[model samples]
Target chain A: MAGLGQTLGRAATWPLTLAARAVDPPLRAWQRRTGTGGMAAVFLAPNLLIFSVFVLVPLVLNFAYSMTGGTGILLGQRPFVGAEQYARLLECQDYTRPITCREDQFWTAVGNTAQFVIFQVSLMVVVSLITALILNRDIRGRSFFRAVFFFPVLLSPVVVGLIWRWILQRQGLLNLIMVKLGLEPEVWLNDRVYAFAATIGVSTWAHMGFYTLILLAGLQAIPRDLYEAAEMDATPPGRVFWRITLPLLGPNLAVVLVLALIRGVQIFDEAYVLTGGGPGTSTLYLTQYIYESGFASLLREPGLAAAASILMGAVLVVLTLIQLWLSRRAEGRKAR
Target chain B: MGRIVLDGITKSFGATQVIHGIDLEIEEGELAVFVGPSGCGKSTLLRLIAGLDRPTSGRIEINGRDVTRASAADRGLAMVFQSYALYPHMTVRQNLSFGLENTRMPKPEIAERIDEAGRMLEIGELMERRPTQLSGGQRQRVAIGRAIVRNPTAFLLDEPLSNLDAELRGTMRAELARLHARLATTMVYVTHDQVEAMTLADKIVVLRGGRIEQVDTPLGLYNRPQNLFVAGFIGAPNMNFFRVRATGGQAELPGGLSLAVPGEGEVTVGIRPQGLHLATGDGPALEVVIRLVEALGAETVVHADAADGTPVVTVLSGQPSLAAGQPIRLAFDADAVHFFGADGMRLEA
Candidate 1:
């Protein structure tokens, strides 16, 4: 009777064991699939979350805000107004009118921002490239000079603006120096033209160091053996710089140009602190215009601000695309 | 044709001296090799001649012009580096034509020269490919072709074949000889390989410890090494040495065996492995116990220990069957023996 009981126990456990083995293949396959899936999701989740909150959601909300009434009410209470805010912004007349349809302040601000971007970005790139070249040379005290040049980049933009404002003030360091040197004191920041130039100069001074460091790093990464070989080939130093170093540094220069352009297009802090977009708004930037329309001014036309923001975003995207296309073309040429 | 005259060339890196006042003349259209161990200043001397580095106190004259301070390009020379140093981004055609382009050579002339060099190097099919696309041997050919298109006064080759494998090195060696013959321009080659030095050099300069030990034709350096260093360095399976003392016009070996002294000194007796013969019955015989026998198809090397356990190598031509641990007697030719003093300088017979 005990032998028969043992036989029955074995017979019953065999099916359970077979069922366990039968479940293993699918379980393993599922585990493998989920493992890869989980790893990929782990890697991508942070970037996706950040992009959704910061970029995608903001872009969608911006478009939504552009199509709504001036007040930033919630979705349920908001009234839809299609394209009217854009029309009003393009045709606004008086500065005090809440939504003037004939004013030119927005366009004037746009023109001023364009001019600032054109001048500041070009000056910044040239200055940074020159500084990078100087710092790249095998001169004594290179590290010290590099630190000195890059120190301005560490300052906050607002602080940099205030420092430059004080320097360019009518009774400030520049006028004081001029008076002490037996020259007439000039109004540097109070005049409209001078204020515009000061804004650009201050912005360039604060930002040139960052680009200089980047360009210097790029220049230093180039192998010294290439230069030695170039010298052996009898190529002049000027030609070597132009043909070899510049072409090889094309990617780095492209990065600098794109960064400077984007920063120039979005300039706001220096204008706000140094000039207050003032001296007749000569140094008013696009971002300042957007800020004034959205929150700073008495009438907060969030819809017009959202439209302007969308336009600026479009311009930035277009500019970035053009840079990307140019980089691709350069890479294609190298591949050939 | 260009001859290099290095006069009192001295170079120092801060406190350490590299080339200590080397004075030599390289004949025009001759392939001269600087053969030395590593850190012996052989490459440094070549760089000095190429004007890549300026000597602290010296003059380098190429084709009778003082170019000690001239740049490498101004010196009218092209170099093939050990690393090959091909521009990774440029095609073979571009690499060969770049220097010419810098000198404002005409487009058609540059093309012609490129084609000529490509044909000469048999790299015509690889002209459009980048250096990264070529094999090691093919890249080496392109490097050589790049130097050839320069039409410079002299060619400075710094261990050009050190990168190739053994079989490819042999082939490239023959190719280099042919290239030199065709060009017939002066060539200064540097290498640590004695075989390369022996086979390729019309004149060889043996350097040690940053000083020239001897400079002579390959056979001259082989047959007439000035010191023990040169003797050991110039030959494969180097000459064997036995410590001995000279007394009463006879050299007393350490084992109490006496042999006639061609010269007198407390000396190191030197005999080439090939110079020793197996004694049959009646000769100046020394009892030896065989340690190892290496049988090559053409010659058999018998490594043995002398009566007093001094290591001796005996090379026997035409197969002589010899076994390990066998007792034998060996004799060395009297004329083939070399005697060096306690100072390691050779004593003239």
Candidate 2:
């Protein structure tokens, strides 16, 4: 009976060992795939889902709503109006009003936004590049200076607007300083020109630091030996900076330009807080126009607001594509 | 061509002095090599000559002009670095023409110079290729070609062949010697390889501990070393030193074994390994126990220990019959042996 039991035990163990070997590889492979896949899904799913609901869904619904005349909440009761809003936009008149009325406000906002983006983004990028170059040098107390420059980027845009508004007020810091010096006190933020200037100044001061830090990183990544070799070859310092440093920094410069352009185009908080699209809408932006059409003031045309937002998104996408194409071409040249 | 002169060149970083009051002169068209172990200031001295670094004190005269305060570009010299230091973004043609371009040379002249340097280096087919696409030897040739186009007063090379593999290093060494001969320009090369110093230099400057130990031709350094350091440094397997006591014009080795000395006083007897032979009969001999034997077909080196446990190596050609733990007698010609005093300076007989 003992011998029979040993034989049965051996018979069972053989099949069990073969089964374990057969299952091991596929099971481990599945475990590895699921482990990485699950971790990736955990990190990416929340942002993807939130963006789809908040950004993508609203974008699609806004395009559909722009083709219709909406008087109620989105996805609720509304009537399809068939391009009437666009026609009204082009005719420079209110469709619902009785007689002919000028609609110069919309066109004025577009021009102001364009001017602001052009002036503000260019000035901000140039200032940031200069600051980054200075900080990249081997100077003492560099980290301290870097922090001091970058402090403004961390502030809320609303707070920045409020702070500048106080500084530019009629009897505010500028006038007070001027009176102390026994000079004539000028009306600072009251006129359209001064208001636009104040808007550009505040935006530049708040955003230049972030771009400076990014460009500094790019500058530091360049090897110092290249400069040494250039010097040995009798290449002058100016030529080294222009030929070697600038061309190598093309990718970083492109990033700063595109980011500044996008932020400049979508500028809303400072203009809304300081100007409220006022002084004849000199500092008004496209976003403020969309907002005033949707909820603020007496215009409650959600379809027009949706159409403007869609148009803004399309412009941003096209601009980003052009920036990407430029970066790729620069990389191709380097490869050659 | 210019005769380079360094007068009282001293360099200090904070408190530590690296190159201490070095003075030397290189006649025009001489291929001089500065060779030493690491941190011996050979590379620093080269940089000083190239005007890449300023001397803490003294003047550098190139062809009888003081260039101590001149910038590297104004000094009119070219250098090849160990890392090759090629501009990765530029093709071979652009790299060769960049220096000329910066000096505002005409476009046609730049093109002509590029073509000439490419053909001279035998890299005409690689002119359009970037540095990353070339092999190590090709890149090195391009680097040399870059230096050649400038027509500088001197060429400074800092271990330019150290980056190549063994086989390519030999080939490049021959090519560099050929290049120097063809160009006939003042060239100062720095290396730590004794063999390279022996083969390529018209004058070898041996350095030790941030100072010049000896400066002479290759055969001069090998045959008549000034000190024990040079004797040990210049030869392969090194000269063996055995401590001896002088009495009555005879030198006594350890363990009471004795040999005749032509002079008096205590001296360290130095003998090159190739000078030693296995005596077939009675001769001036010392008994040694063989520890290890290496056979290389042409020669066999026997590593052995003396009766007093002093280690010694005797190299013999045409394979002697020897084995470990065997007792053997080694003899060397008296004319081939060198004698040094207790202060490590050579003593002439």
Candidate 3:
């Protein structure tokens, strides 16, 4: 039948958007009345609806859960003990020394997360910048090198963590090489500092490729004439890098920094899978602490876990605000 | 001391050679221009002199010092690029001083040079602002100011005014000429706009397809272009060409008219638009059908077609007595005529 063919033909077109076709008339009328911004909003309605349901609802519910007590999954059955879970997280005598805190596990996770973020973020920035600079040059087989640099970013975090875990174990490849070179093998995972270092290195290895890709794009966007002008001025290569390359790459670097900051604060999978909060909790991180307290606990204190996550979010928000301020100042300088 | 000599400089990227070996001498205090259409490698030749690129086979000497292998910085030359290439992050003042400061010059001396360049370029008020804050003309001045602060042996400019609007480009071109007069420094400039070369250069190097078409004074190139390519390229409205049969230094035109040349062969006749006289009563004249008349304020240009459909352009002062779809016979002297042979090479008188 012609009708069946029409329906099948319509269904075959991508994004196979039958719903969009149905709404097209009113959307066009609205666009005619209000212009581009209004039509853009109409196009964005479905995404906004999905985000409100999936992300916003859970965020509000978690805040609600943090103010409650007991094992009840439903909010109506739970008894409210407002601020008690928050107070538990804040019960630190000497905030700098996590061991002195009443909630030692919470403070230990914060301390560990801070150490990991600092080490990982700095290493990530330097390593990615170096890789991006090398890859951006006129080296032979540059596309192949770019793919090689960006390969690990496409990998799953669990796969990345497990692979590193095996390699950093007592009888790993690194130690095997060390032993073959007449050096003693290191007990990498059993030691606290070694385990912490392992986590930072693995996380950097997993994420540096993404940042390198970002920085490489930034490098490409720079006009070649600027470099030529610098060469004309006889600017030394090192000074040119410091003066021209780094300053121009400011916005991309800021994006990498903020994303790394949020990811570091919210990191769980790599450290969790590799260390399992082992070596006397030296590798414990914020998300793993929240995960252990919520579902892995004997009593299953969901409220405590919610409080910890909210605290982590707050720290990330503050860090992001500072980054924005710094980048804005930098952008202002660039304009002048 | 600013004399730069290139002996057999050649450049190639992979298998395709962009610059055939070229030998040239830029005299001290000369404002030399390299002008050609796009892909002519004028900029590449400039880059070779600037030492931003190396020659495949040649020796380059500045003031008799062999600098074929010297880096751009080592060559003590400064360049103003087409994009202006002002450090966007630095203020105008900082841009001028950046190069000087790199050589470990005293801070006070660097400031003195910046002040001098700022005053010379009339950008003193723009010192505190960044490149983005300034207009195109202002950025161009800042770029020039940056070059002046270096006080290098010679200055290289690569189409520094092409980015501006037409009127601004005119102003900048004049300013650049005046700057050269005041500084008396050897300057090598590259541009695709022959007008810029004609108006600015003491010596013009016309190039085509990575080879030098001719090197002469601006009038020397315009009055007597060495070849058909230079004749076509050196004019604004382009030279008019008419196919002609020739024997024994005489050529036959489409309307049974004949022209005398210096040589014998099958040839093409060329005439500048302004070369033809449009007087009602004159000597020998070729009939042309008037197609269109453009009445520009200072001058009027007539576009017409010959009987055989070869396009012809003639320029007259003010408005000329002509109408569309009317036939007019134009007269020109035998001296103004240019003849090219079957090989596309010009026949010199």
Q: Which candidate is the best by TM-score?
A: 3
lDDT of 1 by residue, B1-349 (tens): 7999999989999999988888999999999999999999999999898878899998999999999999888999998888887776678888888889999999999999999998899999999998878988998999899889989899999999999999999999999999999999999999999999999999999998778889999998888788888888887778888888787768876445577765666788888888888888765576789999999979999999988788988889988978999988887667777778888888877
lDDT (Cα, tens digit) per residue for candidate 3, span A240-309: 9999999888888987888788788888898888989889899999899999888897888889899989
Which candidate number would show the highest DockQ if scored against the true structure?
3
Candidate 1 residue B95 Cα shift, in angstroms, is 3.3
lDDT of 3 by residue, B225-279 (tens): 8889999999878888987877776776766667776676678789999898684
Interface RMSD of 3: 2.0
lDDT of 2 at B69: 92
Chain A TM-score for each candidate, in the given order? 0.79, 0.79, 0.85
For model 1, report the TM-score of its A chain. 0.79
Candidate 1 chain A: worst-modelled 10 consecutive residues by lDDT:
A94-103
Question: What's the true lDDT of residue A288 in model 2?
Answer: 93
Docking class of 2: acceptable
Q: For candidate 1, report its TM-score.
A: 0.78
Tens-place lDDT per residue, model 1, A54-169, is 99998999899888885654655667899877777676555444235343667777788888888998999899999999999989999999999889889988899888888988
TM-score of 2: 0.80
Ranking by TM-score: 3, 2, 1
* lDDT, residue B3, model 1: 95
Worst 10 residues of 2 chain A by lDDT: A94-103
